[model samples]
Target: MTRIVRRLRAVAALPLLVGACSASAVFADEAATTTSTTSTSAADDVAPSTLERDVHLFVIQKDGSVEEHDDSTLRANTTSGVDDIAQRYVWFNKDIEHVDLLKAETIDRDGVAHPVGSEAIRDVQEPRSAGAPTFEDGVLRTVIFPGVEPGARVHLVFRKTRTKPLQAGAFAYLVEPTRGPVELQQLIFDLPDDLPLYADARGYTALPPVTANGRTRYTFEYRHGTYAPIEAGAVGYATWGDRLMVSTVPDFATFAAQYRSAAADPTANDPTVTSLAQSLTAGLTEPADKARVLYDWMRFNIRYVALFLGETAAVPHKVVDILRNRYGDCKDHVALYGALLAAVGIRSEAALLNLGPFYTLPAVPGYGASAINHVIVWIPELHLFADTTAGGIAFGTLPTGVMDRPVLLDGDGTLARTPAVQPRGRTTRLQIDVDASGTGTFAYRVEDSGAPAELERNVFRRATHRQAQQIAADRLRQTGLHGTAHVSTSDVAATRGPFATTLQGTLEHFTWPDGTTALPALTSFAGGLATQVQAWLAEPERTQPWVCIGGDFDETAEIALPDTLRVTDLPTDTAVRDGFFDYASHYVFDPATHVLQITRRLTAQFGHQVCTPDQFAQMRGTLQRIERDALSQVVVKAGRM
Candidate 1:
């Protein structure tokens, strides 16, 4: 696991002024800077500005309650001429801080570079012994937590100093800890002490009239004056973090050497770990084999407990306690695995990767040691990246959809380009090719090799006969198709690996307009996930960056009437690919056999934002088109003889 640098990458909408402006002019006249009033050149306010910055974060756990932590930080430099924006954002909640070359560099707003000119000590209100804070290169960085007493306050005070006067379009960022589900809380911006108020937030509500916990304090604002523009909808947010990313250790040879060295030292022998190694030593054939055996043992034995914290999460717990106890959350799981492997002659390091089940990267925000939430063992041998949090998962595959996000650990951590965040196994699409005759013969087969047996399990687990009757049928009912579904039996051939589950069912009086057939034209792509589609249409347009983009299906049905009704209409056999839409719908009709086949595939991982009015209208119409294509009773004027 390599330690990565701080990062920031994309945006769906530009919330700045209509045109670009030069940031240097916002504060070019040093003589004019003496006044407390805001600067002139409102034009420069909307244009992107180059900046050099540093931030210090402190986390305190108050003592009573906690859930699951997903937080960390990032430092990145973006150049767009005078539109350059080089900023460092530290994202750390409780568990994060992977180290590497601490020396960092920066270039300022006027294209000039600078280094941190000062470093000093500041006592946090924590009880734990803090680390020696320092400033090296251009970074004024520190990792410290004077432990917190039970029922005490958790205070995180972060300070940021920049190279130029803060103006319009100039963003000063400081992120907050994400516990679980995020709520929209009021934000207070920090205006210059001497200068009267200057800027306000866009898209979000104004500062609150009341404060809940006076301790929850931190905010950013543009220095108001000539250069600042009071714009609406151009807001800033301190959002959540992505999930942990693990890989097979790519450098197995080096890891093995490190492990052997760590194990030979008498001082490094931990009693609890030594005992466990003894217990499992019989299974070990070689150093790497022992490391793998140890890794597998942790995955199978340990259970994931949901314990959320703010700062203690940053501190890696002693692995000795975790393995002996046999239970822990994301962080503990990694520490225990790393410790066990290290003791037995397999090198294991505590590297932080973003947790995937929560948010994503590049699109949302980037996290370094400061923002990492979960922990995992880096098995450099065999290039294995393991996350013990997911129990029962096989040796090579990760549990579900965490993959491709920039992993910031020890090596490969200094790259400037953030890795593209992709939901690993989501590439495995769920394809149900069912052949329904008298009794529907449903087939569960994956189109892509990435599609695992888990996808089938997830589908069959929810596709209960009763559930299908209620939701699936209700959705079909909305399509003007009448039917009652009874799932006779649903059996998954293999749950341990890639295998299919056969879903055979009985649907009586299933009818569209013509009285007999059901076609692929009647798709559940939208109607099936009507609720999800609605949410996608309504609010929270995009999921967190680390979040996977895949649709969970309810049911896919194909019916053959008593060989009577003829196929009528079909969905548009067309698909359009745009940055915001990946959609295709097709309907096949064989009038000779009175069978209508419908195939609908929707790829809606467009930008995190929702569809525009035009997009939404088109989307809503596509549903109607599919329904209409699936509808339409086959017309046949028969004579009553």
Candidate 2:
């Protein structure tokens, strides 16, 4: 993760206008004087105009409260760019945190210090909200420095106090290194003698701790030239990068225990909840059917609203409140769904999941709240995971983010991994009837399951009939067809089994004109596959490992040509295989019926979601072959009418 330091301007009265207007001019004069005195060198030419020295200190009090102090010094390399620097901004949450400005000043090249005026400080609300209720939680404190220029340094120090811990006895802190080059960066943690603290560092080495003054201080330092700017398109850096994590609670078990204690009683009996569950499962005797009914009710009826203020970050709202309000966040959905399942004699547990790219849990033993960002319900008996917050997801399906990842179950503090779902195959079929005038009528059908099915349901649920028609037309256009398409599907709201879609359209210019003979250049049923391959080939190189969402694609197209046209040339068959991916295409022409049939299949086993550089090269080669095969066309000649 990258750290951003925001700057703002000051609008307060000042003692002299020179401190404001003449600062830039005076700094420019100083820069000329310094350049004349200093000898020119390669180091001087490449030197950065600004350098940051940052120190962050976290002090854990005896009662689990934390006091955080962040101090930084920004030095300018040249005197001319001083006024280009603006006021520093510090962010804090007003709901559970407070900020205090300790020091703000500017130091000139001559070692003269000027303290910032008190009237130069202003507090503003943060524009973005992470959890909900809009942008009401955060406050930004701005400190305006008057004498800023090249060779001038601005220093800012602020303290933030978390009055109450997210969980009563648990505490966790994360330190993400600043981006860009830095002169010095330090992270310090002060802990009481009796409090047990577990610290873990990733992507960097951790130094030893020093104890003094009846307190233990843990320090981690990064000297100049040690930081590297993150590369673009680097995947999974946020969850797997170099950073420090400290937690008071010891392990995942402890974290699960704490969560279970805070969650609603799964077995608690309520007439309203029981009645609703019974009504949903009135005639269903099978456990799976009953579970599906309850799951669907929660998913469709309840809206998702995240409220992670203080303890609510770990605990969930009451089931009664969630039922009455008809809306709740992930945890609330888990709680209510679990209760409903229990009422209907189906056993379910609350499972904590991390929705990021990190599938493997950290080996470090600690009860860190940052480990998991989502919660869902798990049916142990049925061996299924249900995420009610993901509205369109079917009963037994789990999103790729949570699949095959370790989940912390609430009840017995058990750690379990979700079952990995294999790629669900998608099959598309097209039948075309062409006339001698080069116009054709086509019928197309698509069938899909699992994640692909969920995606189709979501797309159709939000799209109007005209939008669907346009989408179909767009897909056809990729196949070199210019015409209108009408698409329809079975009720997307009906949740069960595989999803199916049907489309009918007219194709203009079904054959190309070349003197007397006509060239048949219709788009293949595997048009999307060819496009994807071309897009991948367009990239020079991939910085991150290629991530392929595992899936299978099978497309077949059958075209009936008019008697006036005879097949002259048919596309050649192709088969290519790479690591975890396979592609094959076949073409067959029947002389009796004058029909051309093409079949294409692509299987991608991207369950791991990553491919090494060597593997990617092989995959790209295979895709190129498939693209060539897809672009191959059948030619036709004029025959006796």
Candidate 3:
């Protein structure tokens, strides 16, 4: 797939400070310079396959269009590596970008070259872009290499020409190291002598610029001769390793201003938009309340459609068209919602954002199409960031995915960050009563806020009745119980309050009156402690930074025994307070009533979304302690006759 098409399709799959800071100043402070690692010994430590040679050439014209060429060679050392590099997919936009396959060949271990004929190359539409409105310039060129096996090398060369700039007269590009080891990689930029370039090379060695024949050339080299093991739960590699970011635009302010000019009020002087806005917010007086109403209206009414056809990549459709069709992508949602807010006398700026996995923005200023892929509205009057594209998310709650990331506000040309609200955690209360027949009836309720709340709320809302029942049955089974359960949940549509769900059930063989019986794992429903403990234990030793968003989980359970039974033992109480994590479990047995009460609370409130290995280690120890405590069960026996 083409780089841009792959990037755009990646939207279906899965920020920087600006202001006053010149491009040079930003790069000087945040960019890290590194020397190339030419030795292959370090790469051997983790190499399953190696990138023998990777090169990219970009020629930027004075009119802001780009001509790009790429050449890459991959050598597979193992069978799995062959599978990983066997087939190549080149993606491009049929409308705005022109692509040509320059070469496709495979070299066998015996040094025999097999060139791929035209029959080996297949051109097709991107699967995600097959539908009607979603169909755009997405085209995939699949090249199947011949004689690809372990110790064989596959090579490909392709060129793409962008007839128009992503923006009107600006170009931006970013490249990062692959997950596997790389022997040599080069990124070269050919720019018109008069077009100043802002570039940041982090972990890549930047060579001196050469100017000749009315053009200036910039090159960045990267080499990692040693295998770099990828750790699970680690932040994006762009944050920790090699990256080359370049933009013809001088600063974020310039990029934002240019975008604002191109994306100018699509709703201006549109009476239908104004009328609808008036109808929606007629009764709401407060700006926050009005914003909420309009945001919800868009979420419920407008269907999200990914349309990358033509200039739509950098521009949004007219507000009227979006309203008439009742469907739009993130940018469309922002356009219509912002226009509606405007009609209601509430001002909102369209905030450009990188809704991708990474949290921080590169130091170099970049156009929205390359660096920032999503848009939301910023209500400066209320100092709130609203993402209307999130259908199930509450009005005030930003999905954890976009929290704390940098934003480039249109019109204002300033950079800001979304708030990283501390998670409200999850709480559950469970009560069980055992009769003489060894049957137990229980009532369970769980409530949560923040990201957990958003997730749980959507899960039940989207589930069919049968699916929900299966979920309940699975939860019960996970806790080592067989039962008939009926579940009732609060209305997840209510955006102002915590989300809650209650499960009531009857289970057989809950306990034995005459013999010792082990306690069940009660918190096995949504956000259960036992489940969390197991997950933490699964990854005890983390090599990378952990994504430890702050949160707490609290559960309380009361078990009432029959008059014929007596409790002989209960788990001991334990309290653990560690860095970024606090946990406590308490057991109280009322002998006079034959009731056992248990309370467990775990709080993990890290300062940031990314936590250090040391912090995770401490949290891991705390979870281990909680797991051991959870293993303790109540010992019960028949009452003395």
Candidate 4:
């Protein structure tokens, strides 16, 4: 249950009630139809078994309670091959839901069905680390069928009953489409006619509801003869593709009101909060500066520990508890930060943000909490959204995940979008000096601003100096160079401007062995830019639109050749521009000084992270050009310049 909640917290755009059911569990149960056969080779032994049928049914009661049932049938068909369908497990919160296993059995090729013994079922508590809260409410039930082998089929059926609604009189459920090959896949919802239900079918069509026994049933079904896997580099299929959302809640405004009610008391007038806020901003004259002081203090001091149990999922911890513990989840951070801001005479609202691959909200009309998993403070006066849970984010900037996404303002009950924060252009400057022996010494200064700068700060915060040096060296080696490196950074904890890191390293085999004519190895400049570009372009024919979270990158490298080497040729300069992205590279060779200078910049001005197939083609071309430019070499000859 905790695992399901965690996943829901990450990618959920509707509400946890809608997204908690496990689709993989159903898929695992459906792999029993393939007939047993002898494997032709070892390669065939490890191939994934196919699922025959995956089905789920949700019976929604008039009182808003839901009973979810899943049944899957599958087969193991090859001799001496892995039976991927035999394993089965179900996670449920004992306090909020009841799980009942109706059937678990194995059917042999000869049509003999053997029921699994009760002894095969086991219950266990998931392990937890120290300092992490023990969610004692959840339990995992495992069922192992006997005599599961090639030529045998495995079938499993289970039902879960939610004792109460996540919110009073509000019911929601989501069914995600199966990923692998399947003969039949379906999702059926049985609802009482009296209940108000809003349904959205994304990436698939929803059939009209059928009414019987004073109830209306909504059905969604799909049949894939062969596996249709999502494209490589795609955000999860659930994040962008087929799924069904059903909710009893009416609209976004009502949903916003529910959230506002949970976070009703801001604790602005508390004596302790007032004292701390005063102390934190005593000498700051400007309102923005004072806000920054408060924001930074909360960002560094509060530890983020997510506790999304039954009721606590929606209700934030009390301000007093958050302050005393000095650690809380995103909502808790918002509580403390909001209180401090109010104490300092700055008005702010708690804004709900859905952080992850999801950017646009579903066009479905309903008030569901599944889509929002994080809370941040929105300063109306400054027109700024501050995410204190993002430890080192700049005061005025929002994290990449939250920026440009729809946010629900708490008190106003209004759904609004956060402004996009474009990259200020993180820059890396490199200087390399090579000796006659082909060994080189290098120095690098990296200036990172905006979200990139925040990421750099987190890296420095978690790693020691030696560890940072090793990380830098490993990054340098990715460019096809071998070396040892050292790293130093500006005071990242206190500074708000562009964070900088200075790195020094020694490179081996800096020059290629071509007898008299030598070539300088191309540097893999600026944090895997070439690798990222190649990966983005790996799949040429893309069905789904490409999503590029906004960012900008720049790299400049100056290589000083040894006096014995003279420049002969250089890689061509190139430029590419499009609505989604821009790339430019320039090179200069000085014959007298034996130096080669290269500058490259890549910027993604994608206001909206989504790109159409045509836009993706343009972006792919730009990235390819950038990769070619980054890998270009400097040709040189053995002679005094």
Candidate 5:
């Protein structure tokens, strides 16, 4: 059974459920088929495992109890499949659900069945790292199949009974099948005929609802013969797969109202909270400034805990309690921050959203907390959203995880979209000096803003000294330079403003003093601007939309040569401009100082999160020109030019 709790649910795992063998699965359903088949040349190209049958059945009672049954069978085709699929895990919320495993067995290629013994099944609490605090109350059941090998099949049957729904008289479910080869897959639902059900069944072939025994049963079936085509750099599967969502709640507006009602007055009129909010904003007049002070206080003072146990999974703890503990999860941070903002006479609302790769929200509301999994604060007056849980992020700047995503604001009747991270200016400076022995010592620095800055600080803040050194060396090597590197940076733990990282290193055989050699392009130092586009150039033809971020990247290289050497030639300046992006590279030589200077810039203005094939094509052309110019050579002789 799949844990229906929003925070506990696994988006990718197929829930085990009751098997309905009466209806035959149709693999030729054109509407829901998103995969393509290619003729295999040999067994080596075959998929590791294929689902023989995947079935789910849910029975919803009027009193809000749910009975879920899942039965699935998978056949392993290779040794890798055996190793990966021989073990199965089922998770259930132990607080409100009980699970019973009815059958577990392995069927060999010879058609002999080997039933799993009780010793092979173990029920235990969800595994977490030592001393890591969690709020989850779910337990896991692990099943190990004995004598499982290639060409064998594993079968399991389980049932879960929920004593009561998390929300009274409200139920929701998201049904998404795996993008893998399947012989058959079925979804069956039995609900009271009087219950008003809202469902978004896009890409699924929904059969006519059958009303019998004062109940209506809804069925959706799908099957695919081949694995789905996974494009490189494509969006998440939930965005493009055959998905169906069913919920008793009508729309997002209703969900928001319910959430607001349940989470009202958590921080309202509290004397302690009011006092702290006043002191934090005592010297600040602007609301934004006061908000920033509160945000910074929360980030620096409150420790984040991932516990989502029971009702706290959706409702935040009392603001006073969270303040006393000096720690809370995302919701806790939002509540405490909201209380402080309220005390300062600034209004804010709790905004609910998913912080994962999924961007699109289905029409129907989700049940068991499956709809939205994360919460932040939205200040309408400032027209800015703040995720205090996101450490090292500047105020008014949202991280990429939730940027441009739909959000449901508490008490607000309509849904809203968060602003996207726009193209920001980033600069990379490289200072290089080459000796007569062909060795170059250099200092590389990259200054970044917005999401890039947050990412850089978070990475360095967590990296050990040895790991940081290895990272610097790896980054230099990626730019076609072989060297040893030591890294330097500003206070990485600081929470405000733009951040910079510097790498100082020595490059072996950096240049030939007597002949022509291309000026080394420190490609990696551009912070993925030059190197990333160069990689995209390899995929000239793309059928799916490419994930891309728009930004302006500039790199300047100041190269000082030995006193005995001088530059006689330089690469010609080149520029390419298109609708999607612009690229340019320039080189200059100084005769008196025996030095060379190179500057390369690439500006991508996608205006959106994804780039179409046509847009990528144009960008690719511009990048090719940039790459050529970056690889241009400079001539050096043993005398002045």
Candidate 6:
């Protein structure tokens, strides 16, 4: 009987489920594809808080003019909603509470005016981190599209307590019928002096978005003449949105200190929030302990499923709710992790990432704002980036897709890059000899652990049964023997986290094609059949280095030679080493019997050295030379001994 979860399968032409321990998976339907998206505002659902704040903001537009949206002019309370217009004098409330809002409005194509209302959705909160997400239970969100979209040239006017740039930790995407007639003219983001940004190379059109009047926007026409292909891993990031947007200020520590003091007020009894503030500088005694707790917590809880559909995918469920439910997307997983680290006195931040093979940050700068949707986190203090959303990997290591990309939302308000480490690798192989009747067999198995295995697994994990057979067939060719053969593989259950496959088969040339055959390794059909070498050397300090892994094999063959055959002389056993590669070969023969025994071991030591194609060619030449001396020829006498 086989046990496999039905839900654990690929979706949306992607490897949605990254096998958590329990084996639950995220599924995507290839049929339900989305083609376009609208950039909506964050102020549509939130009600203005009654708490008084001493914050004031000024919008420096292309044309120097000041617009005021203070509290007295509350937006017109009307049945027909009219909150965002170009010239309409309306009260606007930006969705964020960290900064006080003075005024907010939107412009249409004809420059029409309308009053803006508080339609922000505040309750849609997402906790950021690896373990349990610390969610602020109830919050509202935006009901309007405050920031300008690609179509109408839009500008935002607001103020904050600090003069330095304030990043929104946000991201946006523009999708339209590129396959149709419409051309994608441009995708742009307005940058504030306080916030810094970088774009993914693969996601954004290379021409670069147009910037004018202190704002940055990506502009490209989706015409066949100017078409830039967008692949699966495509996503963008910036400081103004959920992307790993980040920024820094000179007095941030002093500013942070003040916030901590204010948060400690008598009315603030929230345990999680208060604990986070208190632990910011004194949580864990050591770094490893902090890492383990966070790693284990995410693995044990916050189940991973890669649903991530439409705008709903962008909107995060409360971290607390995910904690209670014991489930979350990558964002939820990392959101909680970031919060927990903060709670435990570690410095951490959220990262917007692209975790796949087909996508990369668009080469032209600024399009990174469109190239990422998946989120993870980085522990700056520990200098380690961990992946808990998937399994069959060691902690502190990340897969290739997340490597060397920038992290949006870093504290610096600039495009901060995260350094990803490779996964732990392993490989194993075995060799043996079989008796005449094929009943008894002796074998030796070898295993390797490191980078090579990781690279091999990435491909093997994605192959089907047929592909698995080719791998098996390829091994047989290495023996310097050949014949027509059929290959087959064992049935595998999907519950396994790795893409693993096993195959077995035989060469069809069961007998000599002629009456007589020359045998290497023996004088009378059993001469030079053995090789010689010594035990391999190991580096005491350095680790194994391999880009592709999992090169292991076990080989065995038995023989009852030509009607009447007898063992004659067996070569003397020998071993040799040079502090690097090692080899040993042994052979034995019994005169009273027509039997012979042979065994060989070879191990090569390799580290961070320059290996060129020419070097590999030379190595192959050397192996052939050794084979010539070791298994050259075996004579066959017409009579039995």
lDDT of each: 0.34, 0.64, 0.71, 0.66, 0.70, 0.34
Off by over 4 Å in 1: 1-296, 309-318, 343-345, 353-370, 392-407, 410-499, 512-520, 523-558, 577-586, 600-641
How are the candidates ranked when ordered by TM-score, highest leading? 5, 3, 4, 2, 1, 6
Model 6 lDDT tens row, 109-131 = 46654334566313233223224
lDDT tens readout by residue for model 3, 1-641: 13522111111100111111222322222222212222222543445678888788878787767787888888888887887678878766677778888989999999888999999999787765435354455677888888889899988898988786556666666565555667788877888878767766666677778899998887878776653444566555455445566777777687778767766764654999889889988887998888888888888788876543222356777888888878877777888988999999998888877775566666666632335667888999998888877877878778776786788898778889898665567889999999987799999998886766766777888899898887777777767787888778899667656888888899888987567677653543544776766655666576544455667788899888888887777778899887766888888878788778889888866667765556667677677887888666777777742
- Candidate 4 versus truth, CA RMSD in Å, comes to 6.5
Q: Give per-residue lDDT, candidate 1, residue 298.
A: 78
Give the distance in Å from residue 253's predicted Cα in candidate 4 to where it truly belongs: 1.4
Task: Give per-residue CA lDDT, model 4, range 1-641, as digits (tens).
Answer: 21222111111122322221212211111112111111111232333545667677778776656687878777665653224566666766566678888999988889899999999988765432125442344466777878888878778888988766555555655444444445666667787776656655553346677888898777767654433445565544444554556565566677677777867664546899999999999988888999999988998898876433222245666898778878877778888898998898999988876676555544432322335557788899987888888885778877767876778888787888887555655777889998888788989887887767777887888897778878887777766668778888898665477888888889887874334644543443446456557767768766554555656777788898787877778888888887766888888888778788888778867776555555666677667677777677777776665
1-641 in candidate 1: lDDT tens per residue?
11112222211010011111111211123213322222333344222221122122211122211111112221122223211112222322222222222333333324333332223122122222122111011222343222222211112223222222111112222133221111222223232222112121221222322223433222322122222322122111122221111111122232223222322333235787767866786766676667656666776687666432112322334565565556766656766776677667677554444453322222221222222344455676656567666654444545542443334444333211122222222111122222223223232222212324444344545566576446444533554533343232234423244443222233333343333343333344223433344434342222211122343232233433334344444445655455434555455556455444545455555332212223444455544443343333333211111
As a TM-score, model 1 comes out at 0.45
Better structure of 1 and 3 per TM-score: 3
TM, every model? 0.45, 0.77, 0.88, 0.84, 0.88, 0.40
452-569 per-residue lDDT for model 5 (tens digits): 7766877888899998888898888767778788998878877666788899989888876666555554434634566657666656565445567678888888888887676666
Please tell me which model should have the higher lDDT, number 3 or number 4: 3
Q: Write the per-residue lDDT of candidate 2 for residues 174-273, one digit (tens) a residue.
A: 4444333456677677877566566555433456666778777767665433223322333343343344555666666877787778775543567888
Misplaced by over 4 Å in model 3 are: 4-46, 128-135, 226-228, 266-268, 306-312, 367-370, 434-439, 480-484, 508-516, 521-526, 533-538, 541-543, 562-566, 617-623, 630-632, 636-641
lDDT at residue 546 of model 4 (Cα atoms): 51
- Candidate 3, residue 97: Cα displacement in angstroms equals 1.0
Candidate 1: what lDDT? 0.34
Q: Model 4: runs farther than 4 Å from truth?
A: 1-51, 75-84, 108-131, 134-139, 144-152, 203-214, 235-240, 265-270, 306-312, 365-370, 512-532, 575-583
lDDT of 2 at 312: 31
Q: The CA-based lDDT of model 3 is what? A: 0.71
> How many angstroms is residue 98 displaced in model 5 relative to the true structure, after the best TM-score fit?
1.0
Q: Comparing candidate 3 with candidate 5, which one achieves the higher lDDT?
A: 3
Find the 10 residues in a row with the least total lDDT in model 5.
12-21
